[model samples]
Target: MSGGRFRPLAGVLAATAVALTGTRVSAIALPWYVLGTTGSAAWTGVVAFAEMVPYVLVKALTGPLVDRVGPRRISLAADVVSAVAAGAVVLLDALGALPLGALIALVVVIGAGRGPGDLAKEIMIPEAAGRAGMPLERATGLMGVTERLAQTVGPAAGGAVVGLFGALPSLGLSAVFFALGSMVVGLALPRGMGHSAPAPADKLGSGSGSGSAPEFGSGSGSESESGERVTPAPRRGAGSEEGYWRRFGEGMAFLRGEPLLLTVIAMVCVTNLLDAAFGQVLGPVWAKESGHGPVLLGLCGSVMGLTAVGGSLVAAAVAHRLPRRPVLFAAFLIAGPPRFLFLAFDLPVVAIVAVFAVGGFCGGFLNPILGAVSFERVPRHLLGRVGGLQTSLSHVGVPLGGLLAGAAVTVAGLAPVLLACGAAYVLALGLTGLRPEWREMDRLRARPATARPTADGPVSDGSSGAEGRVGVRE
Candidate 1:
């Protein structure tokens, strides 16, 4: 925990925040730009769909590459590309040469870069935490806090910039943020920080009896921050050309074995789909139709972002103490339906923002729980590939959501679409609450980190009896 050890984390955290802020700014700017210029909800949706397709596709397929090339390199490169893409949009607009086709293409480039860039940063958190002598939960919480803060700052800033100057200026600022993010990564983080390989499987169990912290920069750890030892991971051979698919396959196989993880992944995927529809397309359409302008759009998001930041802070402080299953289910129940229903109604703008804020508050607890479980389950060495796949699955429905919602809004009115999606959100949450596998979330809270499993069940060594928590990538 020396100042020297803390430098990398500071850099990573700053880079993550800046990069996230840029993306969020662009998120608001791009959709608003399309809506303003074209005045067509469908085109806005098409642009959104175009961006997300590449985001999800490249993120899903490139996990092995991220693992092999290392997150630092990927993160730096991705940010640079993102900056260029944003600049392209702004430059085109300035030249009065912006077209739907050209805009979509540039946004696609932005998404492609963002996908790996985000995964790389997420992959670095545990590594940064371990090296800095911080607990994993606290580290992840800090990360959640950073994201929530960025969420608050990015949209509010994007909205203000768009409201004052225009969408073009906001896009231009996005490029500045991306470039700054790249600079932070390049200058601040040390080489080979996130690139170490895991100790062989046979070596993992040998350290079970010891209480020492895992060695920093080791790529994998035999111990978690909770003082429980990790289960002996079966090590794979070194990375090579032929090993890429095999590594990718390994990540898939790991996820398949963890049904609870898979369940969480599926649930988040559906919710992310719904959220994309609501945020990127539906929200903008509502703002336009209500004559609220881009300022209201930003204000509503800012309120939600602020409340979500509070929720995330609370979750970070006390997530380990909360009951995993019921708390998680309740958080989702509160978070999901309210915004849609509020938008569906003819309530005043104040009422609408309040509901969105409440939903954002409840939504904040989710990531801490999900992140804890993911880090505890997956060995660090495989985080890039495994995390990438998880991220990809979680976002798979995003493009479809935008596309379908756009078409639906074009065909049917916005009110009906809002009502239907709201009802669907309620139904999905209710169904998930009833699933038997959900009980596993609670069970995981009682298991130790070091507890390994055979094909049958967990290996019951006395060392794994310590407190447990769980996380997921979404």
Candidate 2:
């Protein structure tokens, strides 16, 4: 069952890399197009708001869909939509027919696709790793690297491409990336590879044999058979379409039962909310107004990203040995508040860059650990549905963060806004730490029950069947 075809996996990876380029271009291109065409800074904000609203709204609804239908399908469909949207922009602009309303509509559509797109990519890594017989920890390490690089390079590349050749050309390039990404995902992935978490016989029939790992079950359907070895999945029996209310309830029920996972999700939501407020809106404004000018702003942004790269490198080296709880704790501690302080102080390039870099590094180190922790702690069956819900919740904060930051900056001084956000981050940390489940952060990493085998096949010396082990540490 573990015999995986590496060629297919390699193809997915290649597709992943190419498809990811559009993410970079979209980040810079969307804002440019909005601001340029609308000629209103306020409309720029509106466009961002419009885009993120659907991303959150749809993702919250689609978590179960991704779990049921399979990520491969979602990714394939999204890539097509993304390419069409970008192409449409190019087509409309070339003909001088692109209107602000149409542009906003497309941006929102792309944003919605992005929610599922990001989740599919993130979830696929572990599925492939499982197929290739790769360790989950190693897979997560690569996640950290990809995230750091994308966040770091994407913006600069987007800016440079847009600045030199204009938004349409850059957007055209984005269309190309999406087209390639779509083609590869649609054409290259080995059949049956995308079934990360098999649903019960009801919804998914049977997966192609990529069942959940150890602890989690997605609850789409669960019929346990004694002595069934938890390995790759089998094909599901059928697909039953249920009402949206029923599916949504099922997804929520799964999340509610997973307290440990729920905590992590909530924590992420809090952190993202605060960070988004500062990073996307306030920080940019501060940089523009701080006498740093565009060139210096770009330099500072680049430097900040590089810091994240360094942080990710350090995390990769030590993550397998680190306690999961502390990783979560320390990441938040380091990531929060510095942005507001940097703004309030209006420090020199050296000081601001140093602070931003530290913030970036902390952020880079944070997510993979959380992701590894989240995925590791749950039952395998729930990865997609749970991932969907979790991702939706985490992203919900983005728009809120932006809104909060905007209101704070408007009502209070920038310093107060940062402080308020910082305080919120701290509160989140404290609350998450209070939960008993967190104390077992490294419980899963403890020696497996068979570390000291008995007369039986394998049993824990000190723990019960499936008793928790040391976690976070591999």
Top-scoring candidate (lDDT): 1
lDDT of 1 at 231: 52
Candidate 2 lDDT at 24 equals 58
**Model 1: what TM-score?**
0.88
lDDT of 2 at 277: 60
Worst 10 residues of 2 by lDDT: 459-468
Against the hidden reference, what TM-scores do the models get? 0.88, 0.77
lDDT of 2 by residue, 303-353 (tens): 556676677678767776776677757765766656665567657778776
Candidate 1 on 50-117: residue-level lDDT in tens? 98898888887777887788779989999999999999999888898988889899989998998888
What is the C-alpha local distance difference test score of candidate 2? 0.56
lDDT of 2 at 69: 74
Give the clash total for candidate 2: 28
Error of 2 at 88 (Å): 2.9
